[model samples]
Target: MTSEDPHRLEAGHLPTPFSADEIRAATPQGRTQVVRTEPLGGAASTRRVRYVEPDAEGVIQVRTSIGEDGEDQDAPVRERVTWRDLQSHASYPADRTSLERARLEHPLGDLDCVRYTMGDGDAVDTVWFDLARPGLPVLLESRRGSDLVLRVTLLSDEVDPG
Candidate 1:
């Protein structure tokens, strides 16, 4: 599996909310590269993390701003995660999200996907992803009432299923 496969999530992509346990269950054997970006406004900063699990190796590319000019610095950092680590973090579902829409056009303008809305009132989160292609997150928006806290958008994705 390579990141430059030009697969574009294929077709008929849909996403369902994976409970906390489900995410934990999928940690091991499901390794891929994810690229996401957060637009800057708060703290005048943006971050990007690309998780690389090559041959059971846990590597990540961390990018952050530095200095008063907000220049960016990127570095590759590896923090391996084993099956036991994931199992230790697994837990029962605390909250559930319902499917909000289907066949929705992703903001990236390439893939068709689904949306799930979770949380309540002041702490609502909306996530969209392609179940057919589970590499990078599609889009994640978290808001507390009328104020938006964080927004992460997919930049690119390549799945390396080693």
Candidate 2:
């Protein structure tokens, strides 16, 4: 899907806490993307490529794990999350701790993003949502004190199974 205005998120006003219907409408029915995690401490970096699509039951995720040697390590595993669960996860709490807008650069390219930050002090988590794809997150960052404990990035979503 193409954006009507690529810069809308940077300049225009946006509805905070996107509604479920708005997310459903904005999200593509199917997507195949790579998720990457940065290595922390002595651990190795990891990558997982998964295909997610909608079915009569709800949404299905087919994930294939990649080994540290850069090869598939296991058979694909499938899981389904019901529509009820999707909706519940999509809902925003009545009181949000913090919200902001920013531009993020990812493997998918540059995107205008809306960021939601929760928690305070040493315990904090932040999620950056691509404005073009309302429900999907482009990046998730977790920080402990002054150090970044974990970071997950959505590499790309242009890999179509068809």
Candidate 3:
């Protein structure tokens, strides 16, 4: 998080918010079961991550709308979230290394907290791990330029016990 404390990548390092187990462990504790994945994408697709979960299958690729203004207003960006079958890390690309940016204050709603970014490009994955919360993606936001197209805030969550 801090410059002094740099991110170290080692074997078996998963850059994702949390592993499948972590998400399952932090499932809703009691009768409350309102927590769930935000309905960003509703249609079925093999290339996009329509919804995300611990055992949900496949890695999610955040889609960014890329185009120039006044180019074509009729063809507005139509994005959807979908998932693919989970592939072994050995087969996964190694380019997804962590690219830590900074440790600064991230204000979600009214509460201001310290958070950091990982991965490269205009929008990196942000997590408030230090904020002391459970489950994967305490807050995972995907943005296109300054406009926030999608945001996953953990309000309440759980996996159906089988």
Candidate 4:
């Protein structure tokens, strides 16, 4: 957010103002996302499907792995105020000074994203949230030095916006 920030341009942009309606419009009920994950050291990437739905209280997300060595594994069901809340890192730095804006290209399409980078010891994790989709994460990556440790990309959304 500052001029000296390494991730931002010399001329910084204003922070995005978000509303509940914008978040709701971006996320629909019964939507599913296809996610791909690549781990460190060239390990085989894995595919996962995440189902999203809205309940009277909030949004629910259930994730299950695709083909792998063994049977499919289901991740614990998550409930959140919004679908994007499920992917949020509560412990991450919350200061606007740590935020950056970037154009991210994913299987879904080219998108404008709000980026946040955090470092812990030797590892650095970067998360990109789609600007058009409120809190939806388009990509997440972790690296040590220059070697990628993990990467997760939202490949597609099954729900049609219409």
Candidate 5:
């Protein structure tokens, strides 16, 4: 869906929603090669997945989130951070094995997502990874107060090979 799509949000609204195929198509535009995609189950009021892109070295992890029409009541709150940061701060694992272990230890029921509530349940955030498409960056959306925040995390392996 081009940037002109009506479903595309402006300002604080959020980007337009794209299907798995659409996301895959856009991967090439990012200049990186897309390898594969895998869906991560366990989500409440939304769908989530992890996009895996492998380059010369390792695979890049991309997380994604899609809101449920009726389920999302509040506005969106967006934020971005590295896997290392998520691991250090939010108890998210930097690696897939650790993440899977955490999932088994603290399952989110049938949903493959985790909900983090802040400030007396008035603010809530849910996180999931989309491994469905390579080259596609990780997608994150947060809802707080009357605004919805959306974030896309791209892997800069080529530019920042560390």
Candidate 6:
């Protein structure tokens, strides 16, 4: 899809305890474009931000990632991918009817799932996608303590790339 398409799903969560700047800097240029910052769900240690980028077939996803401090830990490098890849790799519970309903209602398309190790030596998995509009991306974070899920919609228009 062209970059101008406003109806794209782009959302995901970052592992806890990592630097936002580092993650942003490391994100592939143009492929994943940061949109803006968003409020955290609760007492989460990580930060959230929205983004937009083309998937494998060039479909844009309104994406987000949660970042935490990863300086001293063996956290795997933050994993990122196009929505197309995520959609292909997503695995849902066979008996979870509610989850299946949710998927059908708000499909994440390409921005599906990602797994990474947290600083506390635990694995954090995230699933994200567009629910209603391209600007509004949903994020589901599963960590050690509680499962944190957030739905963030695009709040602003495209930032002039000038």
Better of 2 and 5 by lDDT: 2
Please give, for residues 1-162, the per-residue lDDT of candidate 2 as tens digits: 115532123223333445444544544455666677774675544555443676554567677767767687788888876544444443333244467789988777788987877666686778888878645578888888878888888866654656
Write the candidate numbers in order of decreasing lDDT: 2, 4, 1, 3, 6, 5
- In terms of TM-score, the best-performing candidate is 2
lDDT of 3 by residue, 13-102 (tens): 434333333333443322122222332454211111112233343322222222233122233333322121111111112364343433
After superposition, the stretches of candidate 4 with alpha carbons farther than 4 Å from their true spots are: 1-22, 42-53, 68-91, 94-97, 160-162
The superposed Cα distance between candidate 5 and the true structure at residue 143, in angstroms, equals 1.0
Ten-residue stretch with the least lDDT total in model 6: 13-22
- Local distance difference test values of all predictions, in order: 0.47, 0.62, 0.34, 0.60, 0.32, 0.33
Worst 10 residues of 3 by lDDT: 84-93
lDDT of 4: 0.60
How much is 84 displaced in model 2, in angstroms? 4.6
47-156 per-residue lDDT for model 4 (tens digits): 54344665443566656665566346656456455522432232244443357789987777888887778777777888887876654467889889988889988776
Q: Decide which is better by lDDT, 3 or 6.
A: 3
What 10-residue stretch in candidate 5 is worst by lDDT?
Answer: 96-105
Over 4 Å off, model 5: 1-86, 89-120, 131-137, 153-162
* Candidate 1, 56-142: lDDT as tens digits: 423333334333443445554545553323322221123555555456465556566656667775788776766555333477788
What is the Cα-based TM-score of model 4? 0.65
Residue ranges of candidate 2 with Cα displaced over 4 Å = 1-30, 45-49, 68-70, 87-96
Best-to-worst TM-score order: 2, 4, 1, 3, 6, 5
Q: Write the per-residue lDDT of candidate 5 for residues 60-98, one digit (tens) a residue.
A: 443333444423344433333332222223332222212
- What residue runs in model 3 are displaced by over 4 Å at the alpha carbon? 1-116, 130-132, 157-162
Candidate 3 — what's its lDDT? 0.34
Query: Could you give me the TM-score of model 1 versus the true structure?
Result: 0.52
